[model samples]
Target chain A: MTSIAIPRPAYAERPWILDWLMTVDHKKLGILYLYTTMFFFAVGGILALLVRTQLAVADNTFVNNDAYNQIFTMHASAMLFLFIIPVWAGFGNYIVPLQIGAADMAFPRINALSFWLIPPAGLLMFSGFLFGGAADAGWTAYSPLARGSGVGLDLWIISVIILGVSSTIGAANFMVTMFRMRAPGMTMFRMPIFCWTMLVTAVLQLLATPVLASALAMLYIDRNFGGSFFDPNGGGNAILWQNIFWFYSHPAVYIMILPGMGIISEVLPVFARKPLFGYKAFVFATMGIGGLGFSVWAHHMFTTGAVLKPWFGFMTFMIGVPTGVKMFNWLGTLWRGSITFEAPMLFALGFLSMFLIGGINGTFSAAVPVDFAIHDTYFVVAHIHYVLFGGAVFAVFAGLYYWFPKIWGRRLDERLARIHFALQFIGFNLAFFPMHLLGLDGMPRRIATYSESSGWETLNLISTIGAFLIGVAMIPFIINVVMAFLRPKDQPNDPWEANTLEWWTTSPPPVHNFDSLPEVHSERPLWDLRHGKTAH
Target chain B: MASHAVATQHKQGLSNGMLGFILFLASEVMFFGGLFAAYFIARADAREWPPEYLLTPEQVASGVKLEVEFWLPFIATILLVLSSVTIQFAVFSIQRGNRSGLIRWTFVSIVLGLVFLVMQVYDYSQLHFGVGDTIYGTTFYTMTGFHGLHVAGGVIFMGIILARSLAGQFTAANHEAVEACSFYWHFVDVVWIALFTTLYIIP
Candidate 1:
């Protein structure tokens, strides 16, 4: 057997700052994304703790109503926009090419541009807090309210528009790279499921984001120019805002979840020591989820009295079937396999169990009667946090642990990783599970304080306690990351004996991903390499 | 056998420039698709489109306005369509190593694109409507405003390609920039044609 020798290019002359600032390299840009998103995640987490503390005791006056509103509003907006979306984009920028056996993303300079646009947009959004207050109309920014609010709402609108531009450019780059820059033998079917989900996610982002931009622009015009796009007095309908907003937002929800789903699909197969059960079924389910996501936007408006209730109700229930099929496929993959409970595996398992509960509760909301009972309650908050925080955030951690070695060429400490996992898992459920009970007892979300006699004191206190524990769990994970970077330990290729093509390369792949692209024999090309049918 | 195999492999992959252009078009389609969906929903719910209170209420309220006046945009549309053709000729000339033909057609396309843009501005000025005055005014201006921006982008693209061509930077094999610019110009042309039919000729 012979190994191909790859020549390393000589270092070019450039300042360190200039090198990163003007970089078209996907790897460098990916690192930039990782750091930026992590910063925002911490900021969002602090806001979360503040909201919990205020709610811990009934009628507590730790913060005034205005400050309380800003905290919760900014918390939701920061976590959803600044953290989750960018984190997925960061991971995709780094790993998708490696998984597909390519050197870098297609349109590399545009990829850099997409990431650079985000920080400025984040600054615009958060700077509002320092000036007067951040947007307090919830992350949804449901018009009339947003329009009537002060300069903070105006800033929020501009920030979202800029972020939409960034997302669109990134989506365009991803589509091109996936379609054109694959390794020689990697066909659409042969590409990893994560890449496929990304392809679908990029398409959804490209299609759906612009509508939101237009809606925001219209709202801007209405607010500034005496236009009546959503003004009831000027012959515009408030219902119009709901329609335009959800047209993009329902798909935006999938944009948040699909990438996480992709991460799990990749993780589950590897840890199960089995080929993914029903590969084609998983692909169809992914497409089904993306397609159905658009039609169900009206489900969010069922309480608004604008959309046809029965029709939205039916479409909403239809979405549940594909989601159910996905759950079955995950369980089927684990059936009778030699499963290892590694950190990544543990997180993936947590995502599945928690996401299932979220899914069931989400279906409950689709039923008109149930939704009426829980419309603005903490129950809805619990349900969505389970999905987004438990489902998406857990999978994100799993991917980070799984790919950290591949990115840095060093192993993260296993002991510290397990401790991080246990604290996070325990703290997460305790924090969110009690919110459902409080919601049923008629506690609405986004309110600063509740009366002592409202019967919500005990539940609120427990939820707050759980939130602090989750914060403590984050410390070990941060330490483990820093230690891994300081100690440069060499690891063998295929450290996990993983089934994907990425594991076949060096721990940290070269600038160009591969010396010569391998011929893919199946979805699990590394499996074929291990069996001596293919060579590295 | 190995040499033959490598040649076959080389033939299979697309040029990066073409792939980038296709992706750009896909994103543009979604951009315009969103605007179109808004138009359809708003129009469907309207009791009297262009409204009885509009500035041109006499003409619109009587419901007897000639659709032919809308075809004035078709003139600008035709000029854009022809500009796309000229740009393609320019790219083809570059690919065939005909520098003179490339230079001449590139200049002609840019001139036509500028003329079309000027006429579009003129058309907007001539309209007896303002964006906030009526539902028709709002939708019409927003849709056309975005389309005009696309045309402006196409003109800028042409300008860049022209500058690079004059510098003698492109070659027979590596003129992907010229090729991509032409593709973009054609895309702008197609979008205008669709916009023309839907907004104007369809009534």
Candidate 2:
């Protein structure tokens, strides 16, 4: 790559710790977000292993039931709130401004404020263990049960509300940045697909997160203030919690994965050596998914006997349409192109294959009758992990590999990446796949153990082995990162011959991102730079 | 490579700061939307405005329905709506480079906002029930209480605008902060009207 000099902020020369703490740079904040969320991911993963250990054999005394409940509850809480949901914001914070050719996020100080809220929130949520016990009522924290849970539940509610506020404001920042901060000649249609997905994701966050906040507040009131928002005795409907919680949560399901799908869209075309096919259709499909997300929350309540069975079931099925459009769009992007099997592509493919199973399995619960048989069972657990772990987590790896050169200015070891990918893919399936059969055979979820004669022992042991293998898989990834740091930061601006605007600048871009952005005449500005701008 | 500094600024309809504030308002709308939805759901599910099932036996034996006073809250509602107008005038004054007018109108809005909060506190003290009393108290207080908080927030927002105006920070061409403050004040005002209808005027 040709050497070029660019101006940077004065704070870049400051002591590293003080710089990170005091600086409002979006890229630095993005890295902070990534590190923080990844730490929580490890924390959540350890909790998963513990849960698996306890459930490995029937009636095994790994942990008492109460400890098991808190463990699993913290696992879901950490994964959903700390890991999957905010990781996209991490990626978005770094990449969106670069992709749009802007200097920083719309509100840089507000961006810092958004990230600063996460650590204290995570610490407070986990601090519950020190007080007495962590929140044992599960992540959902349904009405009277949560009301009766320990002080940990109160801490959980407050921490989640703080996190929600952080995300809400962060989302508003994203929309404004995307809408108003694009470079000259870049229209809405000229945006990269990831920005499009973030746009939709931000819309969902801005609208849905506040509803969750309101529900949490009501829950807090009910638990502490004798408010009857969810108390049946106080003329409050218990279903009210379900209605409001799912209202945010079902949309939140998309908030967790749409960005993953966005990452997949980004990785596919680059590896396939083709422009993303159906770019406009993919954009519309993303918006369609966000729109349909609101209607499908009640599907979760199908077993409660309070919701309209057919309506929610039908809406749940309708979600399949937009999702199917996205799936086909991805397949089209990869069709008849020079496809390569790099680590990012491998993980993207893993997401495609696994998320397909995840989507199909989720639809089974939409049948209302089938949901009755499988609700609160291992089948539901299997479905969630497939989507979250298989779908979103795979894309997270794909994104990390694909953007590592741009973010860190060095390439991770390709050989180690492949090994890491293979183990994670195999171990992920092994861990989650048996739960489907176990669910069908009547192994209920959230239980510490089953009797030896319950016939769940073999599958449980297999899942335990698979879960441990996943833990083992992280070794290669950690080694890859550490090894990459020891090498020279000699990567070119566009190492993969990628097409986005971020690739137009130097690797580990200057503080202002781009000294001079390439004129964007099309969505693929780099492609335009290479091939010369085509006539409209 | 010799660097060429090309402009990255696009011709957006609204400035970044204004757009961001508007988006912030959109989320605030959803927040209040959720609270109001809960209020409506509770109201719809009830056979009576203050559902009979939630009342204490002693309270029920007294044979009086739960009530909110129209007079005090109506006055409070007028004050908040007037504050919105005053904030808008402040925005206009700043846009016209009238710093004194900006300060005057902003101070008036802040005073009006504080008065509205004082009226709410006075009304709360006179209430027949507390937040813990019943579902009626919960929904009523949660909705209006949140709106009251927003009013307080708007007052602070206007105070910042007032301070900036006093420092001669905003001019005719660049008063984005003033405009954003007006937008929030208007949003709080609209929410107050909705709360007035839901809590005070609704029979």
Candidate 3:
């Protein structure tokens, strides 16, 4: 390869620690984002274990009520803000430029700033623990209750706003990089499916996240400056906060999952030995989901009765149409093909089945009557875990395993990966599946204790065991990664025989990202390059 | 290799910097959109403009009229609108390779923006209603106060633009910052028009 001909810059000789701390290189920054977000993931997972242990049996005194609230709230906060959202940015920052055959992100320094904001914000959010207790008002931070929480809640508000800024700028950077920086022949249509999803996700972040910032600001003012934005006694409406928060958050649900869908799309066709079915259809369906995401924010508020229930209900159901399209797109990509069950593919299939259930169960809440039954119950919690944990988390690992060789120039042990996948798949279902029964039995969420006669102890205990199993699942993954790193940079350019431009370059490609380029003829540019250009 | 990237970036017609700035403004729109939606929701829920029963008797006794007085804010609005025009002139000036013209118009725009901010501060001082008075006071101040902050931000943005202009940093061929600053200034102005209509004129 001609990569050796490229000269190293003066700054490349900096101390490795200073190199990491002050680097503006997208690849290094992407690694920083991944490491930081994974650290938070571990922290969030520990908190989840605490939550499960507390709820394992009726009237459990593992943790008292106050600590339990903070535990669960911080669990969701850390997982969603610190892990799921920015994890995508991590993947995008590393992969998008490479896939598009660009040298680096369009605004490389701004890209660094986007990543740097996250760690401090995360520290600030968790710093509440050192003060008194962390924010216990739930990750949603519903008004009235949120208004009265301690300084911890204020810290949460600021942390979220900081996170929102990080993502907002990051979103614009992604949009610009994807939109303006694709290779010569790569039209928007020819761009990789993952980049397309990141594009839609960026649009969502650019538009929806700032609304969340505004909501956080209002909540802050209400708490500190005696503003009455959410205080009903002051002639302000409590539900206004929900309206604004859900407006951002409902789309945020898509922000959390769409890139996962993108990952599944990229992985399926590669392992299946066929191009993705209905690639254009998948792209439009993605755009459809993003557009429809805004209208359905009010669906989260239907139990409040302040919104027009029928309109929101219909819009909520309508969102399922686009989501359903992408599901079929995935299934169609897999049907009647020589599919492999490698680690990435294993997680991809897990995403398909679990995210399918996640989608179907979500449709249940679109029915206003059903939502009335399940709102704020374990069932709602079940739906979130199924989608976020099952869908997004699975895709996250899929992308990680798929790109592991490329990012680090070594392959993860597939045997350990399969073990990791199996334990997680089983543990995930065991942990969350019982919530369906518990919610149907009218066991509410966010409760610190339940009576011995509540009949929830068995299911809760089972779920706790499953949550631990999920924690156990991480051991194989960690071992696999450490073992790989101890070896050497021995991977070839196309380790997975992948179908995009990223695979056309060397694993852990040089500082300029590419030493040479391939002509892009279709979505599967590498595939076409291999197959004598039959693509059209 | 780097030069090759610059070639493709311009294929979109909008430079990456300008396109990104526009998207940034789009987010700013949504931010204010949230505040406006809150204002309207608060207005719809209240039977009285100020929801007088919720007001403190002390507030009433201290001469809080529960009203948004007009003329001062109206004049401030005009200054902001004119500043928007002057910034556009700055952009156009640079586009024609007129260095002195760019500096002169940008300097004028900065003055207009600062005066508008001062007028807003003075207007804020004349108001008897505090942010804690009621939802009326809260929404009004939050929405307009945030807009005031953005205006101050725009002035700072123009300050940098002016300094760059004097340094001969921008030419007719490459003055994306001038264009970006104009877009941001216009967005601030447009948000103000909305705030003025809703908070000052609507009732």
Give the best candidate by DockQ. 3
DockQ of model 2, rounded to 2 decimals:
0.61
**Which residue runs does candidate 1 get wrong by more than 4 Å?**
A1-15, A516-519, A532-536, B1-14, B54-75, B88-97, B127-129, B169-174, B197-203
Prediction 1: B-chain TM-score: 0.84
Q: Report the CAPRI category for model 3.
A: medium
Q: TM-score of each candidate?
A: 0.91, 0.97, 0.98
Error of 1 at A321 (Å): 2.3
Could you tell me the TM-score of chain B in model 3?
A: 0.94
TM-score of 1: 0.91
Give per-residue CA lDDT, model 1, range A147-176, as digits (tens).
787677788889988888888889888887
- Screening candidate 3 with a backbone cut-off below 3 angstroms (N, C-alpha, C), the clashing residue pairs are none
Ranking by lDDT: 3, 2, 1
User: Among these predicted structures, which one has the highest lDDT?
Assistant: 3
Runs of candidate 3 exceeding 4 Å displacement: A1-4, B1-8
Overlapping backbone residue pairs in candidate 1 total 0
Task: Quote fnat for model 3.
Answer: 0.76
Cα lDDT tens digits, model 2, A455-477, are 89999999999999999999999
DockQ for all candidate structures vs. native? 0.26, 0.61, 0.69
Across residues A1-536, which tens digit of lDDT does each residue of candidate 3 receive?
54345557788899989999888888989899999999999999999999999998888899999999999999999999999999999999999999888888989889999999999999999999999989999999998999999999999999999999999999999999988888878889999999999999999999999999999999999999999999988899999999999999999999999999999999999999989999999999999999999999989888898899999999999999989889888889899979989999999999999998899899999999999999989999999999999999999999999999999999899899999999999999999999999998999999998999988999999999999999999999999999999998999999888899989888888778776787788989888977889548
**Which runs in model 2 stand beyond 4 Å of their true positions?**
A1-8, B1-8, B58-65
